[model samples]
Target chain A: MVDLDVEEPNSGLFVKGKLEETNPVYKMVPVWEKDKCTFCGNCQKVCNFNAVIQLHTQVLVFPKLCHSCYACSELCPTDALPMKPEKIGEIKTFHQDNLTFLESCLNIGQEMAVQVIAHTNKILEKDYQGQLIIIDAPPGTSCPVIEAVKDTDFVLLAAEPTPFGLHDLKLAVDTMRKLKKDFAVIINRFGLGNDKIWEYCQRQNIEILAKIPNSRTAAELYSHGKLIYKQIPQVKQEVLKIANKIRQLSGEPK
Target chain B: MRIAFTSQGSTWNDPIDPRFGRAPYLLIYDEETDKLEVIDNTAINQVAHGAGPETARKLFQAKPKVLITGNGPGGNAARVLENANITIYIGAGSLTVEQAYKKYKNNELKNY
Candidate 1:
């Protein structure tokens, strides 16, 4: 399983894996050299993200806003704005029995989670020899989540059963439909909220594979960084059912 | 001394917008000529990010000696103003442009 939520890679908290390999990911940012700069403002003008600004006597580059496009660094006449690789995030590979876990984490002040996620996917594609890749994508349908699920065979959306949950679930459904991805839903805390999500799923013709029961025991175990699949019989049954469906979708024999 | 204020409208009576980057108009008040120049910030508003620094860059081109605004500039915008040698006086969000200017002169505004 790969945790593409680099901003908050919490899957490591639950998965008991021994650390295997670690790698640092870097993004290029234009570093302004004081003496060589003519202050011509070309770099500033070329920057579409407003990452570079030419003041009266000095040039300032905002590292966070920089998308690492290399426009300013490449177009500089004096070579004052040289491109430098700055460490933005790190990737860790772990092993637990036969399962290999890949987790990428962004640095505290890093603005680009998509960069880290893309890098993590590259690592998974190149290094890992796993047959079935389960990707735990970040919540919401933003750039990072899109990057996570873009190449996946199937997406499993786990949702709570509430008004707010239904609202976000609709957004996720819309996004999935727009992406033209094959996906199924899993209603978490099933007995808690009204059956609006179920009704909505039925209307949309979305297949709900399983419903994990609302259990305080599961929540308690999760808070302590424990996996409840073994301890909680209900959660284990639902998870096993989902696993079987996923295997079937992937054409894996029972 | 030239002073810059981020305002909602082009007039002096317009309430000072607390936001430096996304303000509707940037008003530059010239002390010597008693003239006011309004800069349209609609372009900055349309940008996805770095609005603060972009707005700061525009404000720098106007050559304002000081900036008077509501909550002062944020991290990225503040860095630009600091490098440009421009002082920032804040707590003008609740005041009008004229009142902010008066407060700035009275040293009643907080220096950011």
Candidate 2:
């Protein structure tokens, strides 16, 4: 499983593995050179981020504010603004038996997550042509989620049955439709909320692959960082049902 | 000396907008000229990011010596104004544009 939730990646905690490899990822930011600068004010004008400011004495560059668009560097008249790589995040690989979990994490205080997620997608998954890859996408159908699910063959949306859940689920479904991607839904904490979710899904013709029941035992096990399927029969059955549906979708019928 | 304020409306009696980045109007009071200039700032709200900084960029172009807003501009906006040698006085959220100016004169506002 590749966890693309770069902001707060804790998917690896569910799986036991030894750390295999770690790689740092960087994004480019403009650095100002004092001597090379001609006080042209070109860099400041070109920067949409307001990251580069030209004062009377010297030029100022705010590293955190830069979006790494390279506009200032490319447009600088005197080559005062040059692009430099700044570490933004890291990718870590863990191995246990036949499972390889790739976890990518964005460094704290970083503004962007697309680079880290895109980099994570490029590594390892390319060579696994026939293997089953389960991706954990970031919450919300925004830019980060777009970067995570854009390349996937299928998207499985996990949502609770609350009013908030129905709202977000509708958004995700709309986003998937807009992206022209085939997707399914899995309603979690199924019994906890009203039947509005069901009514909405039925009206929309959205196929629900599985419904994971809300159980005290499952919640307890999950809180303890233990896989609920191992101890709870009801949860295990639902997981198996979802796996079978996935197999049928993959055309690997058992 | 000229002072800038984020205002809800174009008039001096309008309440000051605490949010500098997405304020409806930017009001500049030119003490030297005994005049007030109000610029529409609704355009920058449409920007995807850097609203604070972009607003600051526009605010700096007017060359205000000091900024009086409800709450101050955020870090990104603050940096740009600071670099431009503009002083920021905040905690004017409850006051009108004219009242905020009075507070500024009386030194009742907190300098941010």
lDDT of 2 by residue, A1-254 (tens): 88889999878879899999999989898888888988888888888777877666567787777878898999988898889999999988889899988888999999789888987877745766677888889999998999999888899999999999999999999999999999989999889889888888899898888889999988788788899888988788889988897788788976
Backbone clashes in model 1, listed as residue pairs: none
Question: How much is the lDDT of residue A61 in candidate 1?
Answer: 92
Indicate the docking level reached by candidate 1. Answer: high
Candidate 1 Cα misplacement greater than 4 A, ranges = none
Q: Native contacts retained per candidate?
A: 0.78, 0.35
* DockQ, all models: 0.85, 0.46
Per-residue lDDT of A32-147 in model 1, one digit per residue for the tens?
99999988889989999989988877998999999999999899999999999999999998899999898899999989998899888887778764578998899998999899
* Model 1 per-residue lDDT at A238: 93
